[model samples]
Target: MSLLLEEISIKNEHSFRSKIDVLPHIEVPWHHHPEFELIYIEKSRGTLVVGDCIDNFNDGDLLFIGPDTPHIMKNEDSYYQKKSDLRAIAWVVHFKEDSFGKEFFLLPEMSRIRKFLTKSFQGVRISGSSKYKIIQHLKTLHSAEYSQRILTLLQILQVLAQSEDLEYLASDNFVETFQQRSNQKLYQIYEYVSKNFQKKIELEEAAKIANLSKTAFCRFFKSKTKKTFSAFLNEMRINYAKKLLVEGRLTVAQIAYECGFNSPSYFNKTFKSTTGKSPLQLKGEK
Candidate 1:
C-alpha cells in the first residue's frame, strides 16, 4: 500500500491563509509538501518517520519538519482501541518561506526564526525544558489572534533555535523525493518488515514483497535506506528490547526471546555490539 498524504487548507476573509491544523487521531500517511511544518503532539504515542529516520514518539513530543520532507505518524494498536483514551492531539502549522516577502528571513530581527527553519530540513526533535516551552506556545497560538499569534509563533521558533536538547533525525544525505510511484515498493517493504521484524525474516520473503530477486532487493533496499536488511532488523529488535527493558517487567532471557532472538547468548552479543551494554546492564541502567 502507498502512503497517503493530506493537504491542509485554511481560509479567511482577507487571504486564503493556511491556518494550522489541530488534528486528533489522524494517521498521516508518508507524504511531503512545500510548506514548512511545526507539529506539537500532545497525548499521543506512535512511530514517526521523518526523511530517512524512523523512531517512536510519546506524548508531548514536538517535531519540526521542513518543506518536502516525507513523513507520517503510525498510531499503535492501543490508539484505536478506545478513541477517547487515545487522546492524540497535534498542532500543525504550515507556512511558506516566501509568504511574508522576498528577504523576510534576511532581516536581523528574524534571524532566530530563519535559523530554526533552516535547521528544520535536518528534522529537529525537541525534548526536556524546551519541549514544555514549545507546547505552551503552541497552545497560545491556537487561541491568540493578530499580533499575539505572530509573536507567539516567533517565540516558539526562537526557543527551538536555542534549544540544546534538540536532536536531528534525518540522515546526512537526506534527499527529498516526492515520487509517490517510487514509494509503493518502499512502503510495501516497510510494512512487511515492521510487522514481521519480531521473528526471523528470510531474504526470500522480503525479496518477494519488493517483487525482485534477493540480490536485486538487497541492493535496492541498501541504496534507499543505507542499511542492510539484517542490520535494519537487528536495530529494530534492539530498539524493542530497550523498550521492554525500560518497562521493567521482563527478564533478560525473556526479553531476548520476546524480541525474537534465537538464543539468549546471541541476543546478549548483539545487544552489547549495538548498545555497548549487556542486556542485564541495560535493564539495570534504566
Candidate 2:
C-alpha cells in the first residue's frame, strides 16, 4: 500500500518558496523534486532517509537537500508518544537553480558558496553556532519584506558556505538510486526494519514488507542501503544499545539482550566497531 504524504507551501513573495509541514505518523512515500530544500526541524525525532544515507534525526536539526534528490522522513513509533500526534515542525525552503541567477553563485568570488551547493546535493546537516544563526535568519525571513527577504536568503547561504561542521549524509552511489522512483519500496523496507529490528527479522519477512521475493528484496535492500540485511540489523541493534548505554540504566549484558543480540561478546564487537569504543568505555566517556 502507498504511504500517506503531505506537502504545504508557506506564503512567500520572493523567488523561493517557504513551507511549514507536519508529517503524519506514516512512512513518507519515496519522491523527489527539482527544487533545492532547506529544512529546519523544530520538534520530533526519526530516521531521515536522504538518498542512500540512513541516520537518526532529533529535534532542532537542520538539513539542506539538493535539487531532485529522493528523500523521505520516516516516523515510526519512536518518534511520538501517541499515534495521532504530530511528529515534527519543519521550515522548508525550495528554490530553483536560476532563482538567484547563475552569475550569483558562479562569480569568481563565490567559490565557497558554489562548493557548498555542490556538496549539498548529497545531503548535509548544519550544526554548531551556524545553526543558531540560520534559525534566527529563518525567523526574520518569515516577517521581512520582499527586498529584506532576499537579503535573508543570501545571509542563510553565506552562513552555509562558511560552516565547518557540515556533514555529508549520502554515499557515492546515492545520486543514481536517488533518481529512480517507481514505487515506495524503499520507504516500506525502512519502516519495517525500524519497527521490527529489535527482534529477529528474517529475509523472508522483510521481503514481505516490500511484497517482493526474498532474492529480489535482498538485492534491492543492498543496492539502496549499501549494506546487507544482517549488517543493517546489527547497526539498528547497536543504535539501541547506545541509547541504553547513555541512559545509564542498564548493564552491558542487559542492553545486549534488550537489543536482540544473541551474545554479549558479539554485541561488544559490533558496538566497538560501530562506535570505536567498548560499551564500558562509552558509558565512562559519557
Candidate 3:
C-alpha cells in the first residue's frame, strides 16, 4: 500500500509545531512527512508502526522519527468504539532539520546532537531518566512562548543526545528504503516490495518498475540503500517472519512460505543470519 504524504501546518509566528492531542481516538493514519517528529504519549495504549518495526506502546512512551519516515500510533479497537470512554493523549512536535537555522546543527557545539539526529532516521524510543526529562520539556514546550519554545526543544534534543537509555525502533535498512519517498522511483520500488514480498519477486521485474536495465538498477539500488537488491528483499522478508514468529500462531515452515521463502531450511538460515536467532528459537522464546 502507498503511504500518504502528510502536510504539517506551522503557525506564521512559529518555527515549529507543538501541541497536545487529547481525543477519544487518533484520527491520523499511516502517513509520512518531510519533517522530524518528536512525540510523548502522556496517556494511551496502542500499536506503533515505524518503518519495519511493529510493537506495542503504552502510556509515557516517547518516540522520535526523522524526516520522511512513515509512522502511525493506532489505538486499540476498544478506543474506536463509539460507546468506549477511553482517551488517547499525547504531546507532539514537528520541525525540520533546518528549523533552527541552516548552519545550526553543523556547529561544533552540536556534534553530539547531530549524530543523534542521524540515528533518528531509524526511529528512537526514549526511556528511563531521558524519557522523564524529555516529557517535562515536551509539556513546557506545548505552552512556551516564542524563544522559550525553541530553547525547550533544544534541551530535549540535548537530553536525547547524551542519554544512554534509548532503543531504536525501526530496522537499520528499512529507513533507507523510505527516506526518499518523494522520489517517485524509490516510492514505487518500496511499495512494490512491501505489497508483493509474500510472493516471488524477480530482479528483472523490479528493474522494470524503476525503468532501468537490470545492471543499472542493481547498482542504483545499492547506491541508494547500501545493500544489494536481494539483500534488501531478504531483510524485508525476515522482518515479517519475525513478527509472525512473535504472534505464535503459525508454524515455522508455514511462516517461511508466508514470507516468500522457497524452503524452510533457507528461511531458517536467513533468519538466523539476519537476527542472530533461528525461527524456532524465537518462537520458543515467545
Candidate 4:
C-alpha cells in the first residue's frame, strides 16, 4: 500500500551516487527515494516490482526508475537456500533532479533527455544496442573522475533518449498513491498483501495492517495506489499468474485458482483486462 523512503547520500559531496554491489542475493525490501535510479542487474533472476508493475527480472536487466517510484527486486526462492549457488550483482546509479543544475535540463539542446526523464515517471526498461552502450558507460563511471563520470552519464542518457527499444513499466493510468515520509508502515502493508494476496484479503485486515480505520483506509489506499484496493490486489494476483503461465506446468484454470480467482471465467476476463491477453492467448504467444 505504501513504501518506505530510502535516503541516499553520496560521499565526497558528489552530486550523485554510483556503486557496484555483489551479493549472494538481493535483500532490500520495497522502498522509494527522491533520486532517480539506474540499475544494471549483472547476475541473478527474480521478481521485480516497479510501481504497480510486477514481473521477472534476469541477468542484464537494465532500467531507470523515477524519483518516488517504489521498486524492489526479490531473489527467487532458490536464491535463498542455504547452499544456493546463485548470486546477485548490480551496478546502481542514483542522482537528484538537479544533478546537472536547474538550467541544464531546461535547455533546448537537452530536449531529448528532458523527455526521457519525464517518461521515467512511470519507470523504464532500456534494451537493444543502446542498453549495451549504457552498461559499458556505467561500468566505467565508477572509475572515471568527477568530470568524466558526468560526461559519460550524459552520453548514456543521450543514447537512452534516442533509443527505440525501451519498455515503460507501470500502467498508463497509474499515479503516485501516497505522501512521502510515511516511513515503513506502507512497506509493511505491501509485504503483507504481497505475501497473502493469493488468498482473499478483507479490507478490515488491510486497514489493521496500515493502522487506519477501514473507511479511512479505503480512501487512503485508493489515493496512494490510483486504484481501488480490489484492483490493486487483482493486479498483483495477475502478476503471479503471469509467472505461473510461463512455467507452463499448470492448466489455465488451475493457475487461476492458484492465483486466488474464484472462477476460471472471471480470471480469464480480469487477465485480459489487466494484461491485454487471455491466459490461452498468452500461452500461445509464448
Candidate 5:
C-alpha cells in the first residue's frame, strides 16, 4: 500500500490513547495520522522512517512525532521468519493537541510544552538522560488511571520541554513538502526503494514503479523528496552501513559489500562524503 492516513480511535472514557503494542513485526505500513505520537520501543531492532529521515532503532529508543507525518518502523528479516519467535514490543501514546482542551496548551504555564510540541513537527529522537526519564513516566502512564495518566503525560512533556537531549529527525524542508502534498506515488516509490536498495536499483525501474515517464519521475521525485533518487537510495544504504559499523562484527570491505556497495574504495568515498568520516574511523571510534 501507499501512504495511508490511519484513523486512530479514542475511547469515550479516555481523552488520549496509551497502550503496549506487541507483534511479530511492525505491521503498520507507511502511514500518517492526525495525532501526535510518542513511542518507546521496549524490544525491537529495525529501520525507522519518519518523513524523509531513515535511521536504525533498537530497544529503549524513544521518538516523538507530530501529526500528519508519514512514518514506519520496519523490522529486520529475522523478525519476519515464521520459525523465529522474535517479538517487537513498544509503549505507544497518541493524542491530539485538543485532547485535553482546545485551549489547554495555550495557557501561560504550558508555554514550554507548547513550543516543544511545535518543534515536534519535524519529529525527534530522545536520548541520554531525557530518554531514560521519559521511559519511567511512560511505564507509569501505560498502567495509570485516567487522572493519573493525564498527570504522567504532562510530566513527560515537561521533561521533554526542558531537555537538551533531542535530535530532530526529518529536515524542515521535507516536513513542509510532505505536509503540503502527500502523494501515493511518492510513498510507493519510497516503499520500493526501502525494500530493494540492497540490489541494483535502476531509475527506469523506479519510474515504472511510479507509473511515470523517466523525465516526469525525476522531476516528481525531486519535487516531493527534495533529493535525487540516487541520493536517496545511497542515503538508505549508508544508514544501514552505519548501523553495521556500530555492531563491529564486520570489516569495512565486508560492510561495504553487505550494504550494496560495488567496491570498498567507492564505499569509502561515498561514506566519507555523506558522513564526513571514513568507515574504518567510525568503526574504531565506536
Candidate 6:
C-alpha cells in the first residue's frame, strides 16, 4: 500500500520523541516519517516492509530507519483478532540528525556517529551484542527520567556507531530512489499495485492508474523506483508470500497460487532467486 506521511508527535520537554507500545497488534500501517527512527521490537512476529525490502521480524529485532524512509511493521492478522490474546510490544525512538544542534555531528568526537548516521540512510538492522545493548538502553529508558532518557539514548548511539554487527536492509539502488518519490503519482501507483497485485496486473492498467500512457508510465516508474512495474509487482507478491510462509499455515503450492504465481515450479524458482532460499527453507527460518 502507499505509505502515508506520518507526523510524529514529540513533547516540548523532550529533545527527541519516543513511544513504548503494547497492543494486540502493530497497527501503525504502511507509513513514513521524516525523523530517523530506531525501533526495538521486544515481542512480535510479522512482516517488515522497508523501502523495496521485505523481510520477517520477530522478538528482539532492532531496526533503524533514516529520515524520509518508508517502512512499516505489519503483524499477523491473528494478532488483531478480538478473541486473541497475542500482542506486539515495541520501543521506538525518533530524532532528526540535527536534533541536538545543527553543528553537533560536525564536531570532532562525533566522527563515528556522523558516519553511522550517513550509513543509516538505507535503513539498518542491528545484530549480535549491539542489538542486546540497544535493548538494554531501551528497557532502562522505560522508567528513566527525562534527563536520563536522553543520556541513555546518546550512549545507545555510541554503541551503535562502534558495533560490528549490522546489516543494511535496503539496497543501494533502491535507496537512490527515495528522494524521487515525493511526487504524489508514485503513491497512487504504489497503492494500486499493492491492492491489486494478487490479481493479474497489466502494465497498461498500471499506466491508467498513474494517469499516463503505457510508455510514459513505464519510463516514469523505472526512473523513480529503479525497478520496472513487473519487477515491483513480483517483489510485492513475494513479500506477501514470505509472510504466509512465516505463518506456516499453508503449503508451498497453495502459497504459490495465493500469491499469483501460475505454477509451483515457477514460484519455487522465483522465490529461490529473489530470496536465495527455496520456499521450504524460508519456512524453516521462520
* Off by more than 4 A, model 5: none
- The residue-by-residue lDDT of candidate 3 on 113-149, one tens digit each, is 9999998988999989999989888888878998999
Cα lDDT tens digits for candidate 4, 1-286: 5556698888875778999999989987778888999999989798888766777788998989988777778998999999998889999999988987978899999999999887897889988898999988998898898689899889989998999989998765553443354535556677677667778789889889989999998888777666788888898889879878987889999998988898999999999999888899887766
lDDT of each: 0.74, 0.76, 0.85, 0.83, 0.88, 0.83
Highest TM-score scorer: 5
What is the C-alpha lDDT profile of model 2 across 174-222, one tens digit per residue?
Answer: 5655456654786567556655666777889889988889899889889
| Candidate 4 residue runs with Cα over 4 Å from true position | 176-191, 219-226, 246-250, 262-265, 273-276
Query: Residue 183 lDDT in model 6?
Result: 61
Q: What is the lDDT of residue 103 in candidate 2?
A: 79
- Pairs with steric clashes in candidate 3: none
* Superior by lDDT: candidate 1 or candidate 5: 5
For each candidate, give its TM-score against the true structure: 0.77, 0.72, 0.74, 0.87, 0.90, 0.84
Give the winner by lDDT: 3 or 6. 3
Pairwise TM-score winner, candidates 3 and 5: 5
Q: Report the number of the highest-lDDT candidate.
A: 5
User: Alpha-carbon error at 202 in model 3, in Å?
Assistant: 8.3
Clashes of each: 0, 0, 0, 2, 0, 0
**Mind sharing the TM-score for model 4?**
0.87
Model 1 CA lDDT for position 230: 86
Model 6 residue pairs with clashes: none
Give the Cα RMSD of candidate 4. Answer: 2.8
lDDT minimum window of 10 residues, candidate 4: 174-183
Q: lDDT by residue for model 1 over 1-286, one digit each (tens)?
A: 5445557565552111324444446667666677778877766787776755657788777888887666767877776675555556667777778756779778998887787787688688889999899888887877777677667877887898788979888655444332333656776676566556668889999999999999999998888777788887787678778878887898999989887898999999999999999988878878
Candidate with better lDDT, 1 vs 4: 4
What is the Cα-based lDDT of residue 138 in candidate 2? 94
